[model samples]
Target: MAAIERYEQWMARLLLFNKPYGVLSQFTDRGSPTARPTLSDFVPVKGVYPAGRLDRDSEGLLLLCDDGRLQARISDPRFKMPKTYLVQVEGDPGEENLEPLRKGVRLKDGMTLPAEATRIEDPGLWLRDPPIRERKSIPDNWLKITIREGRNRQVRRMTAAIGFPTLRLVRWSIGDWTVAGIAPGEFKEISV
Candidate 1:
């Protein structure tokens, strides 16, 4: 293969990363006073960038790609790409409490598109680095929440809106790609 062809092949790669808690989605933490872990620490592959962000406090599947169009499709709201999450909320909410999320939760930004939300058994994920605080008197519930809109902290806010605040959040999948076997701070590459 020609040098240019090799470069193009490299650029067409897609990476599915299992982002651990407290890691920034970007390559660097330029503005923060304190240095923090970022993609550069986990992903050494050059050229690829995260398609969408998973907040520093949140963890799980994050797609990275060097192809701009593919990145846009995964991150852009117009594409309506479904992103699934395994959430641990502060209270034990019943199906009635999750209805609003399925119908569309009104957020400060606006009403979100209806989501696929359901209570789920513990997903048996690896332990979080710091671990979530446990309240003896209060119970937490696990939920499988899938949303098409990529809003900032949307899942956490939605749960709060329904009177159940999120204690922990993990992105399980985006479209057909999933974090199924990828361990924290690890990544797998796929061709576009």
Candidate 2:
């Protein structure tokens, strides 16, 4: 194939990555002593960039697109694509504890839109490394929260506002793609 044709073919591709904890979303981090390997370390694709960022402390699925148009479509709030997270909180979240999340919790930055769905439990999940601090006097609960917006640290902030601070946050799915069968630091390409 001609170089131009090959380039065009590559631009149409997309990849899903299960970002492990401590990795940066960007390719470089100014030689920071604590910088973790980024997508560039795993994906050799030249034009791809993350559709949205997952903080270094958070672990989960991250989407990348070689096509600039497709990246914008997936990342832009205008598209209104939803993202789901499995969050482990520090306190036992009761049905009442979920009311504010369902009703749309108000944060200092702004009122987060009500979660599309909220569940107090999810069966399949892995424990986080350097496990979250445990309080012998208190208990913790797990919640599966789905939201349309990818606000910065939104899940952690939302849970904390309700008095149950988040111990760990993991993005379980994004739009139609999921982290199923993919382990941390692994990735695969899929049709969008």
Q: Which model scores highest in TM-score?
A: 1
Q: Give the alpha carbon lDDT tens digit for every residue of 1-192 in model 2.
A: 699887766656778888888788877778678766777787777877898899988998998877778888878877878899888888777778888988898998889888853656654566667667888999877889888877888898999898988888899898888998888878888754
Q: Give the Cα error of residue 190 in candidate 1, in Å.
A: 0.8
Error of model 1, residue 156, in angstroms: 0.4
lDDT for predicted candidate 1 compared with the true structure: 0.95
The superposed Cα distance between candidate 1 and the true structure at residue 74, in angstroms, equals: 0.8
Q: What is the TM-score of each candidate against the true structure?
A: 0.95, 0.88
lDDT of 2 at 24: 86
| Candidate 1 lDDT by residue in tens digits, 38-124 | 999999999899998999999999999999999999999999999999999998899899999999999999999999999999988
Q: lDDT of model 1 at residue 154?
A: 95
TM-score of structure candidate 1: 0.95
Q: Give per-candidate clash totals.
A: 0, 0
